[model samples]
Target: MSAHEDVGELVPEGTFLRPDDSVRRFAGGTVLVGGSPLWLLKLGAQGARVFGRWVNGGEALRRNAGEQRLARRLLDAGLLHPESPRGRFTLADLTLVTPVKDNASGVHRLLEATDELSERIIVDDGSVEPLPEAALRHEKPLGPAAARNAGWQRVRTELIAFVDSDVVPETGWLDAILPLFSDPEVAAVAPRIRSRPGDAPLERYEQDRSALDLGSRPAPVRPMSRVSYVPGAALVVRRSALAELGGFDTRLRFGEDVDLVWRLAASGHTVRYAPESVVWHDPRAGLLEWMRQRFEYGTSAASLSARHPGLLCCAKVSRWSALSWGLLASGRPVTALATAAVTTALFPRALRGRGIPATEALRLAGVGHLGAGRILAEATRRTWWPPALVAALFGGRARAVTSAVLLPCLIESAGKGPSWALLRLLDDLSYGAGVWAGCLKERTIGPLRPQFTDDSLCRGSGRRLPASRSIGSKAGRTCDRSRSSQRYERVGAR
Candidate 1:
């Protein structure tokens, strides 16, 4: 089926849609800016009118096919999201599959929390003490991916919920997530995994910024997007989709969840991150364990890069932004300012006919550069820190750049106190060390590569518009800018 047909099927009648937090309307609501890598959408007279109505909290009903098509287009572009899923399926259609190792106590705790769910299966991955409640057991300790595959293979339910033994689902967690299965194209949906509450300092940090938690925003799971991959600690998957894809890659002990999510997206299936459905996960017992866990996560980067090349990168930035930062790092502040000014000047020119005001264009360019700096700094700390540390030791321009990169992190944690900042530093170092180790073991530098792209405004105009012919028919033929603006005003006024 065509991409449009697929999206159309996914967004049926009665589906409530909301714009992404990144979405911003300009040019009297005729232009939209949002999506991963940022983008701009210029709407015609009728298109703007329809968009305004729906964006102002109206539903995309079947009666207005134009609005529905527009919603579909925006959704596919990642500009819109399903506000709340309304699925026909119930808990009876789901089978909860928990993969356990030697943590029988954890299994018991999880089972007690979810006792209401009758269809449950526990897969014992060669635990020293066999779990009496386990429906499937392995003689040898298979990795989590293999154990999950074993459990799901024996399940007859249409949907399978994979909750790790270490996780405990919040009450009524499925209420918000189960309905997402109403969309046949969605292969999986993950709940937000928050750290279990505790008074320890490390526990507090984990609660504030757990790596497993993908923030509170809802988003379609895709590589390079805000929520790139969901944790396997708790997620619901369609049995058919898993079977078609041959389940997770058992070869991978780490990053199997990321690999599976990426594969599902590549095969034209949707995976969603539903933060409204919360689940609690126990943080590693102590600081050492926490650091070890972060390191293991970093080690997966090389394997993930091997499986999906180009998707794993240290950083992605625009050429101009990179040049500006490079100039600043080299002590050419004046030159850096000039370069930034030039970039801001070009933004309006690139989007001259897109209905975005010159002021908004300039603001977007500035904001883009600021965001790029953050990305570069994060990359330096996470993947490039080893070389950065070496350069810092030499005490030159590299030292200055390294200090600049680390300053923001320290300042952000300042409010929390010295201990917090120290922990944050350790966190980055541990992860960066693991990344280097993984690269060495795999004999590939793919994970360390940086990606640079043309300015997003220059690329946004090329995005395909669904039912363009129909939209053109309703909006009338485009003319000069003056005429187009007048038409937009007329439609927007209504």
Candidate 2:
């Protein structure tokens, strides 16, 4: 029934919980069953949390028979063995919540792994076609926020692990995570993610760089320190933690995890990074997709900055650069020249201490400028349809006027100061796209069926990640063999 009473019955006493459970406690406070750190009470709290509004975030995944079975099994196990050291756990299912326009190759592997988990789910988040025979539960067409909320509502276990469909877990992934709940205070757990191979070189490089950059950051175990945002790709959260925060903010299109962590920290919860838990992701490939994603990110960042002024300075550069590029892309030679000159003048500030390859960084800067230009061009066209359309289709007087009015100002501003402005701009755009796409039917467009044939994305096709043996052996246990060169042709054979 009630959480406290339910938890009180599980741990009668005298249980040595796993190491992670001991290490993850919130501010060194232990989780108790019958009012002390034990397995039963922990399990009970986990179960109660899974069925309520808190578990709504994971509804889609739990709606599928296969996924639901997994959830049921995990919940059943928790209910039966409330104090067992190995049995205490929760399931946080992650849904990508992106349009079906593109299929990340690693999705199958994620599904494959989910089948093995004690509690597994793949929330479709209103995709064009229900995830290839997986049949994720459908909910109203809401964005990521609602999808996550639905998921949280379906939780039937003590811990909820959110793993994106695009991310494949390494063998023993959960082996490294579940025990952390033994500590009552540890509210959340995040795993390390590496980019899967077989992705485009640029995509791989970006993913690797991001993993390296974010992976090294410290995880906050203290109530006072803000936990680094639990990446949505692979995060394990306690049911109690989810309830405490009241689930993800349905309003945020981007940085929802960051906001969640900020709130959790503000509410005095502990979050830890379990490096032992590994997930592989192959991020989007192609320059256009990358740029689009980044631009959307910039919009979200701007929204965030508007609310949190600390982000304003960082976000300004991207916005300014985008608007400037919009001007230059038009036939505004004078403005382009002035902006270029001003941008060149500001080169010193932009270049300071950045370790990224000079060429690559410059390329990104150029893209940012071009994206801003595109946005401004779109705005202009939307406002004055005929002239803007003509100017867009064929260079015209208005194009020159736009460049003249905006270019000099942009170039001058860029030259005067270097802010992490480009990054902010990209963040805003990516986030904005995510939000905007949520509303448009065209955004959900995907192939009538998977475009890539089995042969196309299989091992010999050069789109596979390295494969390894399962960490432990069990009858009928499956490993995602698609990426293994040895088993390439054998996919679907078993």
Candidate 3:
């Protein structure tokens, strides 16, 4: 079939719509049959405000390129403003721009994220199924990057927020972090990730660790050079700034988030973590699934280290050392025997007390250990980020520690799966580990230093500060004059 033939459907008849902001006419001819609704929007180059539709369908294309359905209509419409004053973007929530796919639970979670975003658009990433009550916006199989670009181009808002398909935004997320953009120098902000409740123990543990890394607690403030990459699960980026950075690196299979952050930093733009902007992700439910995730993460890390050879080589060495240490520490006959016996006895407690059936708890523990090993293998394959290796090698150990700490709390949460207990342990251990590791690294290189002393995080605050400057604050913020004052713009033909 011709590429354009894959345009599954067209806009609905007499679609009820409104014309606000940059749009002059709600044209019906711009849509295709069997595709999603198409609202051809217009955004003036300057002085814009928010403009978009809460669209649904099998995904809609901005413009057709005959046989090339994936062609970028938005990018082709405008020239890059390379010299535009680049700033970071901050999103209050995830913007899921894909066709509705099966996996009911997954879709429900996506819907949760959609509710979180101040604005959201579902591009219908070309679904074969009939459109739901929510029409698809675009139907062509534009790769995510192309769709994202097209979506941004259609955005009348000053910023673009991106969220993954499987993530669910937490409550009070947007209101907590939306004001951080007052600085304008802050171009982007990524959210903290937690585990979805009702999943298996291992999944819960994985999410706990992820959330602790980016939560509201005081994190170590190292030189900007010391900061690592951000995850894209829930990232808000400035539209103009991302356009300047060339949007998402479509070429990457993984590390796209890292690549984007690295490029933003290199360009002298600031990328911050909005701890209050939180999303809970559903981690792989079983041990084998977790292993698959670790392998992919390892492969991505290896490739990343190879590219940044100087900075990453130490991480590689650290990985090997940590692995050897883990095996030596845990695989000792005495230790292994003790762990086996303890683990065996604990199975009953886990079943009765932790709400996990005895069979499932034991099964998950075994898988969790195996998954940790896979993460270790991933670390060894990488050249740097040795701590991550340690995390992998001993992740099961951490899980064991976390679970031990959680048993009481699980019993206390009254069958809540010890999520709170797990979170507390992770907060103390995982985040504490990052802070300690960063500090140790600094001690070797020198004292931990600030990347931008003039920025709010480091300047004269006697008390520990939150990671985000404006998240969760109740008062209106004083706008900084050194940056742009543009608001969300309307995008359509006026």
Question: lDDT-based ranking, best first?
Answer: 1, 2, 3
User: What is the per-residue lDDT of model 3 for residues 1-494, given as tens digits with 9 covering 90 to 100?
Assistant: 11112342321222222221212221231211110011222222211111122122322222222211112111111110011112233443334343233344555567764664555665545545534522344455555555465556656577666765677777666554455454444567667777676555665566544422454431111122223556776777777788797887665555566767767765656566655567777676665555445444433443443443333322211122233336444546465545444543443452232123456445543543443343343323222233444565667864453333334445544544555455433333333333334435334322111111111111213111111111111111111122222111111110
- Candidate 1 residue 314 C-alpha distance from true site, Å: 0.8
Ten contiguous residues with the weakest lDDT in model 3: 75-84
TM-score of 3: 0.44
Of candidates 3 and 1, the better by TM-score = 1
> How high is the CA lDDT of each candidate model?
0.79, 0.43, 0.41
Off by over 4 Å in 1: 5-10, 63-66, 455-494
Q: What clash count does candidate 2 reach?
A: 62
Best by TM-score: 1
Off by over 4 Å in 3: 1-109, 116-118, 126-147, 211-227, 306-494
Candidate ordering by TM-score (highest first): 1, 2, 3
TM-score of each: 0.91, 0.44, 0.44
Give candidate 3's total backbone clashes: 45
RMSD (Cα, Å) for all candidates, in order, is 4.8, 22.0, 22.2
